[model samples]
Target: MEGIEEKLVVSTADVLDYHSILEAVKDCCALFCCLDSQDGYEDKMVDLEVRGAINVVEACAQTESMEKIVFNSSLTAAIWRENICSQKDVDERSWSDQEFCRKKKLWYALAKTLSEQAAWALAMDRTLNMVSINAGLVLGPAVAKKNPLVTMSYLQGAAQMYENGVLAIVDVNFVADVNVRAFEDRSSCGRYFCFDQMVNTEQEAVKLAESLSPLISLPPRYECQGSEVYAERLRNKKLNKLVEGTAC
Candidate 1:
């Protein structure tokens, strides 16, 4: 409990030193989370997330105080399909195929799938209590105060599929609230897909954006044939049940 008094947040670069991690969590519980970006580091982002989790787990095992580990995965990992609109329902069992990701150059989707897969593998192998929240396109005000435009840029549009006719949308606050709930609710295991609304095409996104705020201009429409990475027979009953009473 000596060194755990201070809270430290490390990025991918700082994780290179395993000793630093062990030292930091030597006396207290540790929680590991990652919010990876899709830009650059396409080949290594998955490995980075895996290694990051390993570092945290190893540290926790040594300390015997690591309470939980949470990962912020994306709904893109679940909704990469040619026809999500036709889907009666979707859930955690769904996965985006790497081949389709390669074809569409969907680096963000690839990052989520690879990272979550790595995390799942590690969690099972190490017997770690791990939970992941698969989130949709996060929309809200900017966290950093740097520039409003930078924040607005991300909120302005939907994914290519959403513009074309796929994927869904979730409020940033809802995603945050769910992440917190997952940590507090011991029953929260496996993966939870968090989204406020589902948008089939880019035009739909534009319409919704216009309704939300007249100032925002919708992006141009684009054609995107979704991928069928997983069989449509997968089940998401648990997630649907959870969403039944909850307000987004």
Candidate 2:
């Protein structure tokens, strides 16, 4: 892959420093935010993922050049500890319970939940045109190679997420496609679940587990066949309609 500097200007910036972020994208028409931090690190997570998110949104709101902002969020902000079996189906409307995330020590989920929530708040308060892509486990080869073990831990959890049917996975390329569509489509509003497929059944989960074992660290081993995973019922008519004819 070519470096970002090859075609685009690359500048050093910090998510925590609001002024720095404002300087980076304030002149742009569209901004795609994919900010995140270490999984279990509370301090870094809050500083970068949470505060950083606010800075980016505020920057968008402050900028006159901004037209659209597409924020890349995780399904973790939508799933986890919500009693998946209780809900008919999980979608963008469903938000992962914050208290539940804390109880389960799902620090990453908590960060994402708070960050996305803050982004929405900023959007509404500023009347900025913003869209969120609540994507599932983003599967890409070596995308997080800097910390493979940590990344693998996330995938290992994916087995349970898939088995429960409330979790989904999307290819990296498809994620970018969805983000672009969300920004370009004038009517694209709110959040779009950017998943290619939902593992709705026990057999499908098992297949995925085996297939992903090579990359996932200590992938989940399912012994029981759960036939009642409401996660399988997740559907995004909005995203489907958005990509009906496009490259996505």
Candidate 3:
């Protein structure tokens, strides 16, 4: 891959620092907000996510050059809780129940849901153009090491997610591609669910557990017939519409 500098201008600024973020967004027509907490800092994840989103959206709103903002969110923001199966389908329009998230101590889901909600609220109020990509567990090379916080947080209610058939995965590269598509495609609006596969089978679940080993582990000599596949209720129709006729 080419060096980042060769392809784009990079800047460093704390999301909490409104002035710095405002300055960095200047002269930029589009912005991608992919912010998250680091390892060992999960306790502050909700505060950071909500405030960071507000700050970033406010910055984008203040800039005359800003035309679009692509926000990165999580499928966990929509998949948790017990009654989800009763719904006809889990799609971009669905949102995780905040009370359920709190009851289950799913801070990551709470954080993403609240932050995305905050962003949408401000963007609509300011009449700013924005789109959100609600992605699944992003798996790619060194994902466990590079995105430990998000990965672990996403798996917090693994058994429930698996039982509900909402456990899903998406390639990091695909997520990145979708973000770019969402920003460039004028027709893309609102939220899009971005997942490549569902971990609804014993085989797939085992594979996922194996991949995150050390961070995650399986029983000794574990084996499965790999034939048990759970029903999948999650949908990505909006994402399909956004990428239709385009290379994705």
Best by TM-score: 3
Better of 2 and 3 by lDDT: 3
What TM-score would each prediction reach against the true structure? 0.67, 0.83, 0.94
* lDDT string, candidate 3, 1-248, tens digits: 56766877678889999999998999999999987776623546788889999999999999999989999988988887669877768997789999998888889899999999999999999999999999999999997788787689888989888878899999999999999899888777889899999889999999999898878988888878888888898998778877783322
Worst 10 residues of 1 by lDDT: 227-236
Clashes per candidate, residues 3 or more apart or on different chains? 11, 2, 0
For candidate 2, write residues 165-221 as lDDT tens digits: 666777789998888788888888888888898776766666555556565333355
- RMSD for each model, in Å, please? 7.3, 3.7, 2.1
Error of 3 at 127 (Å): 0.2
Q: TM-score for candidate 3, please give it.
A: 0.94
Q: Candidate 1 on 1-248: residue-level lDDT in tens? A: 47865764543334546677777665555364654543433445656755765665555556677777777777767666555556655668778777777666666676677768876786778787778878765656643233333233234224455543334566767776676666666666788777766665444555556554534545567343443222233244554544553321
The true-structure Cα RMSD of candidate 2 reads 3.7
lDDT of 3: 0.88
Deviation of model 1 at 19, angstroms: 3.3
Segments of candidate 3 deviating more than 4 angstroms = 1-7, 40-43, 245-248
What is the total number of backbone clashes in candidate 1? 11
lDDT of each: 0.60, 0.75, 0.88
